[model samples]
Target chain A: MADETTPRLRIAVVGTGLIGGSILLRLHEAGNDVLGWDPQPAARAAAARRRVPFNDRLDVTLKGRDVVFLCGPLRALPESLTEVARLADDGCVITDVGSTKAEIADHAARLGLADRFIPGHPMAGTEKAGLDSAIGSLYDSAPWVLCPSSTDALPGFRLLTRLIIENFGARVVPMEPRAHDAVVALSSHIPHILAGALAGAAAGSAVKQAVLALAAGSFKDGTRVAGTPSSRTADMLISNRAAVVAQLDLVRAVLDGLVASLADADDAELLRRLQVGRGLREELLDRSMLPVTRSFDLARDDQAELDFLRRLGGDGGYVTGQETDATTVTYTALATR
Target chain B: MADETTPRLRIAVVGTGLIGGSILLRLHEAGNDVLGWDPQPAARAAAARRRVPFNDRLDVTLKGRDVVFLCGPLRALPESLTEVARLADDGCVITDVGSTKAEIADHAARLGLADRFIPGHPMAGTEKAGLDSAIGSLYDSAPWVLCPSSTDALPGFRLLTRLIIENFGARVVPMEPRAHDAVVALSSHIPHILAGALAGAAAGSAVKQAVLALAAGSFKDGTRVAGTPSSRTADMLISNRAAVVAQLDLVRAVLDGLVASLADADDAELLRRLQVGRGLREELLDRSMLPVTRSFDLARDDQAELDFLRRLGGDGGYVTGQETDATTVTYTALATR
Candidate 1:
């Protein structure tokens, strides 16, 4: 029986980069004894410098740890998990922070670690990765989805979830692994892929620099995820091939609908589509729940000056009299709708 | 032959909407004799109450004005320009702030008023529209693209350009009407359409309210253009159908290439694409010359944070230090190289 207050559980964190290192940091911050291991020498060095307890040997890192978190690219997770299951102490719990969990979970089960492995994805990250990127508060207020297989060890699963919520201050949501993968493919993966593609096409041209010069906030925001390392991105696409492809198909269908509307000269339909899009975009803005990091400010104090111009044009427009201060301008409704 | 020091010329602006109202306010602020004309009874009343010279009849407003600026949706521009061209004195110069130039210019030329009409598009606007949305410095330092036919009256074109620069503090760049249409299609029209389409697809099935809640800065910027009126967007797309279609095709080709890369599972190629995108996005942020408006602060600050996060996760590990009162973050060169 695990003691609630004096829990003597050991944890192993593999591939100690941004996500892994962050897990380790947060775990340590919570007073947990953790062992860190990575195949890359730099990563191992990084863990040591950051005072993350490091073992160069994976087997040594997993020898006594009660739980092992596989925090690597989606493609790398399966092999790493397999290695841990083969060499680690019997009954050690394993989980992952990979974006796509369905395939990883399936691979873990195939590698005979299903009963001990729980597929979990922390829905938080910066475009940046690596050991130095790790922070104690990375998972604070973020959603961490736990996808458990039917045959998974119950006590181990519950313990992992409890640790995530209590230690990391994260909200744990349970869902089917495949469903988690699909949702992320639509919300996160596809958008990143598209942004990268758009940027790549623009950059490969003769006027590449000029094209970038003309880019605005929209392009920057839409393509922010494209700045992530290619290896990580590639691993995501390859591992989550089925889900990403499905999302792309949906995107293509939507594009075709738009093309049809344009081709049919259906302005009303096109306008409707635009209106729906605008409404949806506005809704998204209001929620602030998604992982998007930007915000839109619509109010400008100088708006009255514009209204005053319209009035001067003899259109019988009224300017709002709310000038709070020099740097701040506010316009009230001239005539109520 | 126009004298530089001639007392501010009388200008009549029709529409009293965002563009027209702004121009009128700017002209009046510059000490020009400006009058606004709008058919909407409420609009005319509002303008009159604001002490602006308001006239409901276009003919009365156009009678003595030395210039008439058509500022409205594209659908309204051709008729407004035609009306002014028919009524205004032969010497009166006419211009517009419409998005498409070729169609408007062609209509003017066919109407035998090409010399009097200098098609212009001021590359400045907010997501908001209508007279209430107008602001004094709307066109300040913004690019005003001028499309003047070769055989058109040169003096009239020059006069229009001068007025744009002097009255609104905008810089005018002259180009052919077709070229202007094409460029705007790539820069403005295509972006708007893509934004609308993406928002439409992403808004799928998620509760309208929930979707809005989760939206962050990127979604807002990406969908900023979608907030524009459906009629205006429809007109823009329909009026510049050929060019827009071409741009859409280009965008599709880019997407196709990305899909192919993903299918091939080429990690190297994928990384190259992402790096290229990152470089382009960064360059664009640095090179953008547009005025800082409402969206500027939010985007700039968010971008700075993202950059900070990226450097922390970069190949060159982070070096955290204190700089005076601020916590400074720096990246050191990778040990591998």
Candidate 2:
């Protein structure tokens, strides 16, 4: 899609909610021929009001488009993709902005779109929803996880990664679908779940007012994501049930040890438990040590590049930029502890 | 004391660390005769450098002081109180700024300072320590918990409460020592522990770098307090051991239920748990409902006023201000759910 033959990219975002709207706004601002389509007339009207190119017909939205992004609710993804599969041209590489990736990746595989459809999750969100909530700079410096499993998808994956990096200013981290699900469960889902529980406990207490008043900082932050719409949060959690449940077990184990140390009045044990998370945070935040950057020069169609990309992402490395040749991608990763 | 015989206040802050220095700064800035003392020369020097009156002699600092605040480490508090007890005048009502109150209250009881010593806990802090971190506005709108047990301390307690409200701009909350510890164990200590554990789990992960990079907002806030000096956090948790242990059990139970719901794929139960914390946070944050305000006219020396004050604080009420007559106080409490 980004080849010299087609210098001007043709990009379409299906379902213009916050994520899609953001993508459409970004691609359009970057001077790409971007089109948006949402089955909901209200969403279409809103996008039209924002001066986004919203087409009523799926044929027009997908016609000769180089890339199309599915940003509908998880439940509607398969049908949305089915519609795109019937209408989209062969050159159109499909991608998605979804939280959990394994099931969708499987669905793409069954539909013979796995080679072209890259499951992506952008690490940017707010408590609010809808196209009106979308902003042009939503993905600025945000890590966007892209799972490219099929070797046949190498060329499309490379082009999409380049566009996401260049147009959206998103750092692209490529990993396995299952791995992405597991990592995000710990990083996002479990925290949101804990937030709800913590907030609920405080609200349920007899001293709710005092507790809430005292929660000016830590408590408020700890339970901050509990404010996210419950339905959306529930969807993300339930879909990644295995990974989130496993992470919850880990946190509970840590909490159990601290609780025991407290109950036993063991000062040494308690201090030890509390300090476990400290060193890593300090090291992560220490500015003296800069992240290590490495570059990979890949042949556009090489299957081996997928393995290299997976290893880089699995180890928490992200592609910083596509070099002048576009085949050479720069990867930046935290200095290993 | 606010007595007509010696209306101008004479206050002493007996430790020149952050809390002590902040108190000294506030009182000194309010045009009071505020004296400061600390065994550590560095602290005293810092206070002196800031033009806060730091007398080397404890007796001189305590001389004719109407209120002396013993602001020292939790372990050193008893010794600090003993020295204040030895040097402070009969008119001096002694108080200490400590996190937990049970053990210190017990020591005060045995030292015969219980009647005159009003145990206080100010709900304000920063991760950093030392007088260099002191800010004059630390308690501007913060809650200052006062555990006033004995009837003999009523007159002194009244004076200190009025001074804290009118001069320091703090809302005085009156409660029992045991109750204050219990409430804070839930409000402060438990959240700190959770923050440390959550931050630790992320930092300790195999994907630590990726997780930390993605932790721009919610995770950052959730684990913010885990950055507090390990020693101070440890001391607070250990001292409030029993209550923290109990609260941890409650959190663990909630987490366990959420985990089970996730594992069982119980969407209804998961949604229920997540929404538990949402409603309370929404209600607490909604400004349409103003707090209920009431007036309490106390006969300065009445023993029954202690019970009234206790009820107010236990229900999360705080003294907003002292009326011009000084015998009447304004109590502002959150409207009950």
Candidate 3:
């Protein structure tokens, strides 16, 4: 049984790849005992190099662990989850770093492990893969989403969330599995598709050479994600195929309006559409540059308010905030855990 | 009359804006005497602040000038060209830094100034505009294309090309007027349209707010050029409407193929297309990172070789190269002018 009083927890990291290795490296540094399991010998060797205990045997790795983090690629997650679910000790919480969460949640539910499986995804990645690219701070300042299978999993979800927040310094957001997939589909998955499609379109053109020469900041930025490995991008699209198709449908509808405007030679409508686009982009950039402050009417002595303050303190061991009033508070929404 | 031996040349720049102001600043620093004319008081005042001489009278600025550069917005170019032609001295070797060349070349031909007009475009710009955004090194290492009206104007073409090369440190490329328009439509014009359209499409979507929150590097890069002023982008597309439409058709065709592949649920085909895209992007990035070297076989004692050497020497006042043999020569394609 794990000790309840000590802050340090035992973390079993499955698939010692980029996300997994990063998790091991970070959790270990935070005074947690982390054991890793990867089928690949190279990955295990890499984990060993980082001084993270490695075992090819899933049964041995999950012994007395408080949490099991499945950080394998999209295709490997189901099998990895099945193995972890079968072997992990009772009361051990389960989570993952898969880009898609709906299918993983379904799989865990089918295995009668719904309460233990708190699906997760970190919205941070480079166009790199493998253990060599892993870094402890990969999740730093990035959104780390948690999608618990059911309300009954609240206790386990909170445990995993605290670990991610305190150890990884990641912003933990609670979201539904399907909603998470849909949101990411709109924000990230479709953008990746568009980037690749745009790059692909340029490649297949007769003026391909000239296009390459004239590509500036815009073209380079638009197509930056196209440099991601083909298998990785393909896997992401395939895993979330339904959500991706839905997002593509939305994009197609927008393009249809543009096509009609172009067909009619309606310069005014085209210009209007473009103007709206400029405004939206400006708003996004402005929001990112500007800090957002929120004012809430909360009694300082309230339990909920104190809980919020304690979580912030536990996140980085210390946090400072201003008290606006005896019965109200205003602060920047930092530590959105 | 301008002195042939001296590096200095008497130049007149119309519409003292970003492109024109940058040209004036760089050329003046290279010991050239430059005068400017702009209907906008603010533009002329900005030029004056930069110590670039300006006169409200077109006749005064154009007096005895060897070259007259038209650097106005797309909508203002025709009127600017007419006034420059009506006032500038004969054999002034009139040129422009307009994005589109065919229409301007046609306008100059109609005004009986075709023989002296050599249309040019520097394939470089920032999202920012006006004199404040002007920088002396705006054209450095940029592709400065020149489209002379006729071969009989070779002397004038060479002079303008040499000016762009030595004064601005630009790579001067000679192309036909229509060809320049068509190529730029493929390379720069259409990409700008896509950037704006992509951003516009996102804004028009139901998930606009979500997209704004979730936008990563790819979305931002793809939409960077969309932040450019609507009037400017609209002007560019309208000025080169036919070419822009043609390029749009090409893009639509590619999208059609992709949409069909997606509709069929052809994961393999979709992945194939994405793979091609990834490969193409890799090739582009690889080529950019690698330096290109070209070798030309020529006789060392040839007059053509000697003339090339002289131009290179006069360009920066010094030249160096490796000689292969007494009967053969090798040189870098530095001074294409």
Best by DockQ: 2
Give the winner by DockQ: 1 or 3. Answer: 3
lDDT of 1 by residue, A145-242 (tens): 66666533434555675677667876555556776666566656676666776666556644343234234344455566666666677777777777
Local accuracy by lDDT, each model: 0.65, 0.78, 0.70
Candidate 3, residues A11-113, lDDT tens digits: the string is 8988877888888778777778888888887876676677777887879999898899898889989988888888889888999999888999999999988
Give the C-alpha miss distance for residue A107 in model 1, angstroms: 2.5
**Candidates, DockQ:** 0.16, 0.61, 0.30
Task: Please state the error at residue A4 of candidate 1 in Å.
Answer: 5.1
lDDT of 1: 0.65
Off by over 4 Å in 3: A1-7, A48-57, A288-337, B1-7, B48-56, B288-337
For model 2, state the Cα shift of residue B238 in Å.
0.9
Q: Which candidate is the best by TM-score?
A: 2
Write candidate 2's Cα lDDT for B44-159 as tens digits: 67876788888888889898888898997887898888888988897679999999998889998998887799999888877667787888999988889888877776666767
Sorted by DockQ, highest first, which candidate order results? 2, 3, 1
Residue A32 of model 3: what lDDT?
Answer: 80
True lDDT of residue B228, candidate 3: 84
Candidate 3 chain A, run of 10 with poorest lDDT: A313-322
DockQ of 3: 0.30
In the order shown, the chain A TM-scores of the predictions are 0.77, 0.90, 0.82
Pairs in clash, predicted candidate 2: A200-B277, A277-B200
Across residues A1-337, which tens digit of lDDT does each residue of candidate 2 receive? 2455347888889988888888888887777789999888798778877888889888988998888998978767878888898899986899988888998898889988888888888888776677888888999988898998777777677788778887878878888999888788777777787787788777777677766655546676788888887888889887788878877777777767777777888888878877876775675466232466665566553555677678767766777654435466554554323
